[model samples]
Target chain A: MTTSPNSYADKAAEVAARATPERLVVRVRALSDRAIAWLFIAPTIVLLLAINIFPLFWAIYLSFTNFRANRPNAEVKHVGLDNYTRVLNDPDIWVSMQTTAHFVFWTILLQTLIGFALAYLIDRKFRGHAFWTTLILIPMMLSPAVVGNFWRFLYEPQIGLFAYAVSFLTGIPTSEIQMLGSVNLAPWAIIIVDTWMWTPYVMLICLAGLRSIPDYIYEAAEVDRASNWRQFWSITVPMALPFIMLAVLFRGIENFKMFDMVNLLTGGGPGSTTEVASITLKRDAFEAWATGRSSAFAIVLFVAVFGLANIYVKALNRVKQR
Target chain B: MADVTLKGMTKSFGKGGAKRAVDGIDLHIADGEFVVLLGPTGAGKTTTLRLIAGIETPDAGTVSIGGRPMAGLAPASRDVAFVFQQYSLYPHLTVYENLAFPLRSPARRMDAATIDARVREVAKMVRIDHKLESRSTRLSGGEMQRVAIGRALVRRPSIYLMDEPLSSLDAKLRGELRLELKRIQKDLGATLLYVTHDQIEAMTMADRIGILAEGRLVQIGTPREIYADPANLHVAARLGQPHINLLPAGLLPGVEMPPGTKTIGARTEHIAIAREEGGNARIDWIEHLGDQNHLHIKLGEQKLVTLADPDMAVAPGDPISLSLKNPLYFGRDGQRLV
Candidate 1:
């Protein structure tokens, strides 16, 4: 074959002969562009309706009735807003909501500040910056369950590196640093772990914002006689604010529904001190079998998150407009 | 106001400083003078401006502003205003804030009322007062450029350095802004150094023009002198609109060349054309440009374009006798022969 003089020509002719331009009866209808687009998206819409929309409406319907998953054959009574009222008045549920709020607030605040600082330092483009960035991103790359379990050992009083370091810093005994056991320190412990794991995600977004700013703008600022401090406050902060806010929004939503990490770490605490709303929801739906009340609680949480996110997105848009 | 002086200024980049972005060049910009550095891309014009503005440090020379050596001085301390080629206005700031930025600096410590008044004044000067409240990012290219210029103008800096500030605009906007800039500079009587590749901008605006080529200042003089008495072929080719015609020596009659004249630089003003039956040149084509006609001529395998009147009695293939009148002459080294 290698010695054949017209091998390429023969192959070309053979392939050309095989490629018969055949005409067959076409069955596809001439759909308008709008129809074609809808056709292409129909399956995704149907799947979303079946799995997401149907479940959502079903949860809403179930919230209105006193239905118990354990007693499936029992007659479900229509409870007119009774579950909502109960959820609103329940002190334990209130405490869980407060805990969720605290976690969201502290984690977002700490993550934003630390993440923005880290992004600023990385934007300096120093030597070993690539290695440092990769190292910083390791926490975000790990599974939340792994991160939670990993931090659980670190929060241990006797052998934990974190407890030992804190004890050494403050001259306190390592045995007294009951991070997971103490009511006061358990929330802080979870916050620390979450901030450690998710701060890199925020930093990545902020780094994008910082890098989007052209070098000429800084040069122009310098020529305008702005000091480095002034430039950071005026140019750097304002330009990167939208990205920072986006990171906050993401972490705020994710941490609100946080179950796996907290469940893995302390299982809602040494006495429900770290009992976020999701853990309460899980206990109500599965352990207590109060499906109606839990559904109401889930709907309330959904509405609160959706409303807050909508307001936050509007504010983010305002910042971006600036 | 300050006079800028550069002595043996040199800058280079890359390892071991192999690529010289700016070579050794000496220049002096008198106080209240407008100097335009005209060059093609990568000719070190912007680098020269950056070096003077202290955005870049010289590698082997000194830059002194107001007779004070600017060594180790930061750009913010140099008292120079630079308008970048792209409008580098703060996207988060409005037109008014952009204008007020320099005044709000802690170093300036301008009062709020005074800053507001100055911002408005500069905005009005640049004809952007109507859009003062609009975000800088929301502006069109022309409006943004106006805001950028206004931002530079708000401060009473010692020198203004602009790097192709009008190049980003369309032709009409560039023309309007060019006139406005000249007027504003005249009103302020401030020292300004402008760099552009557009010949018309340099020729029309500069009190003195400096031709830069390959990181060297090839020639520096009044625009008229630079256009009429270029030091070399490069400087001669830098200023003309239709471009100066470089022809082999003795291509045309009626001009006395100095000894060793290897090239003749014939612009529209230097060339004399007359219609004839058996002429030495033939009109290849006449490009109609509304106001004036560009006559492309062919003479013995050589082609040259010269500007002619729109109603000139000539068409393609018309034979014409061409002569040179005190045209510029250059030697084999491309250096002008007086």
Candidate 2:
């Protein structure tokens, strides 16, 4: 049968009319959504480029030049890795590196152990858990400089409470003892003070991680008839590993470039025994006016920290994915 | 398998009687029997399970496994396996390791070969053998749940305590796992104390169901007994689908029904409806379900829902005859009149 032309044309028109408005609206909506998304993201991108990327490139460029702050108007000489060679070969630089490693390792280990214990104790949810947590967090909230000064006073041999307490407890003669004046005791002193100040920070993070775990897990562990030690090892520790690593990373980076606490407490004293890399870098750039060498040293320190932090972040991501 | 008995189990939160989470509860679960605890939220089903698992100690009770008092005994000393609702598999461990954990636990003290064999066997039973190497966090919800079941199964404890293990899964998965759980329980022949708020799960899975409200066991019976003869209005309302029709008998005028049947409850399918104008009722609406239709009828200010065949033609305002079959009657105090 042959169809009428007008009827066929009318059917085609009907189909076209039904499809046009919805399609146009959808296209307009999609374009507007894209525009709105870009509008929201533009400021963040610009700020990141200005504050983070540009400065990183500037620092990289500055590392290769013999640029001294005192001789600002002088021509910036291209040193061609001379500063890096000097930093890598210097015995004092190696000493500082060793000191930094010692400080980071001891402080992070002590802080993690102490912090996890405190978090576990407080996670039991007693009558005054909130109050205790707030009290524990006070040291972390205080300025590092203030804590350094306070601990410096406390470490004084004659008038310090710690010295008197130690002498009373151990019957060690305190008359000739000087805590911050000795090479052997100074690094440990700095580590102790740093632990006292920052262990609570680690504890708070650990507490959050611990509390985030559902009680059902512990219940399941119990049902499986896991002993207390087993529960602590398998359930509590593994679940809180990410937080522990996070605490390690924070304390590691902080101790690597530790300046304020060391400067106030020991001033890198006892013949540079307590002088870490950051302190050495500071003395070179500001005190000794070896700005080029110090910049190179700072760059080395930056690369080490960046590499370590990248590895830690990858571990943290893997833990989170699990 | 061993029988579990809770004698005057009472657990309180905070000192000086701040809150009592579980009040004095006395229950006996026989060996190789499946008992389902039904309760509303905060009714202490989970607390009771924890107490039985030795995760929490009762303030004033003796929990016994096989007639031996578990007082002061650690959880490890009490031979009971617990399955949690959230599928508490170690996220860092693989499905194999997760199942092998309890098997290798020092308290359980299975040898390496035995642990390996048990893990393999339970994994096969749960049908998660293929995904044994996969990290538990990567598994789908159903797979993770199966792995959790396998983990519990590997222990071969005397008693099995599950706290709403299938609550988090979707409906289809829940139905499938319910059957699996029942089959596994039967095969293991373990004394299983399961807790769930879903009445259907309790009905389908339990040899006997214990209903709890406000930390007290209100009623305990088999599935047929719970459905056919509910102890109270709460049990009646909570235990049925197309929910049991509740109609006030006093409102029906000139109807000489049973004098003790003040409030009548009947399953929707049990109520009969017809187009004959014998009763004083009018159809309000008709919901055409695929296999059957639900006829919503109004009778003297009460709504009566009736299930009929889909082909039955009924419209709003159509006169209909109504009669309740095997209706349950409740007294004025809300207790069943049975």
Candidate 3:
């Protein structure tokens, strides 16, 4: 499957084919199953191109020119990489980039560790494992906006159970608990919520990986004089690592572009401490009406996440192929 | 080396309709003996082997290795090695790492150099030293199986528990590995309990073969005893190559059975075929094996096969005479009576 065939085509053949006459389709009915299958899927292909792909190239085109959608009567002017230079050079943009990286790093770290541990515990098949696993997954099933606002209320420091519990456990007064008010705690607060919601996503994947291992492998290990702890470390972890990495990659890309959760939590407030790259882009495109600069920012973020994820996926494949 | 003793061992599955996967059966394998448990699939051969390795706890009775009770002992603490029927090599690890896994255990705590030497040594013993660096996923099925065998042999446990280790290989490779495994077992002088449904593997490799049926030990003897003097109708039909033809005792003309006898079991090789124009049976077909011919003789309501010389001129529709040199009789309960 890794070896792709030699015929690499264009982005969307739908527009190309659809642009042709209807007679062209009737003439192509004699094609093989693979070709006919593509014809049947052409509608999806066109929809994805018009939505997912067309806008991508349009963003790239807009990134290279000064085009603001708000001022439709004004003439469009070519800017030639100036937007890229400005966005890259701006200090506030750099701060948002750092914020995005910080959020991505901490959320993935906390999610992977907690999720794998949860999966390991659930794999034991205790009396009530299925019920508990479903209960743990409730947070992930809820809408992000709902969860974000609900947690915001829980961090209110006045009558919030979270604030009161932390105060009771840490011996700090609930009045001093201003999770969204402080810059340091704002990032930590969003990270805590994201981990709580998304760790179950990771745990589901890791659980599948854990269950796919044959029971005989453990039997053979035990017969070879391998202790349970040794089997867990050597056999269980390595075999499940590719799945773990896949979970990390998904969580990483999602957290990098995270918006609604952070927006609802602090609204990039008190300052821009929690203003991730997507939030900054949203402000520039909608608030400040700087379409070209925001497009350039979006392009840069895309390339960064795409390139890193590509590298991580290649490493995952190698681990799988091992 | 160690001897194994299974005393009244019993195991079962399901709750209400519990099937006794391994019924209560006592067996003793002496020190340095290569004993094969032969049976049809799902006949508790594997379950019995697992019970001995401590992989599955017996519902009743006990398993003792070298005269020590293995009641609550973990499989790791039982001084045993298991070679699974499927390729159980760790796919994430290199062949060397897989072979070195047992030595690297905390209980062993072998140093790096010692582990490396032992792994290489085992790899050489299994004839896989050249492919030591290859990861298991990249290895061919045969190579992966060799790595699995090497992994079990690396620790050099006192007893080896193998569940159809060679059943996954092709016929030629299976024969070669059978010889190699026999040599290795002899060289190590380890007590080995092997489980296999293939009669050829059991016949060729076992010092003594134990035939099991319906989770019970039907018979335990040398290959000749089990083959020539089968315990019942099932064992006779199980271990024979061309199959022992079981016919009603009344079908044979001059064959008179005792009061309890109801069936006659005759091996194909024992019956000789002679072409006679007025014989009792007519030849239905002739299977021309290179060295011998198996003639299908139909007599009245029964059909049986008899061996003939390859040079014998025989064809379908030729009247044939059957000479049952010696056929064993079985009672209504399917137990052999002769």
> What are the iRMS values of all candidates?
0.8, 1.4, 0.8
DockQ of each: 0.67, 0.63, 0.71
Off by over 4 Å in 2: A1-59, A73-76, B7-26, B59-62, B251-258
Q: Show pairs that collide, candidate 3.
A: none
* Residue B74, model 3: Cα distance from true site in angstroms: 0.7
CAPRI rating of model 2 = medium
Runs in model 1 lying further than 4 Å from the true structure: A1-32, B250-256
Runs off by more than 4 Å, candidate 3 = A1-35, B111-114
| Tens-digit lDDT track of model 2 for B72-149 | 987778888888888799888899899998877775557889888888899989899998899999999999989988
Expressed as tens digits, the lDDT of each residue in B63-145 for candidate 3 is 98889999999898888889999999888888988898888888887899988888888899889999988888888877888
Backbone-clash count (model 1): 0
Model 1 chain A scores worst on lDDT over the 10 consecutive residues at: A21-30
User: Which 10-residue window of candidate 3 chain A scores lowest in summed lDDT?
Assistant: A2-11
The lDDT leader among the candidates is: 1
Best-to-worst order by lDDT is 1, 3, 2
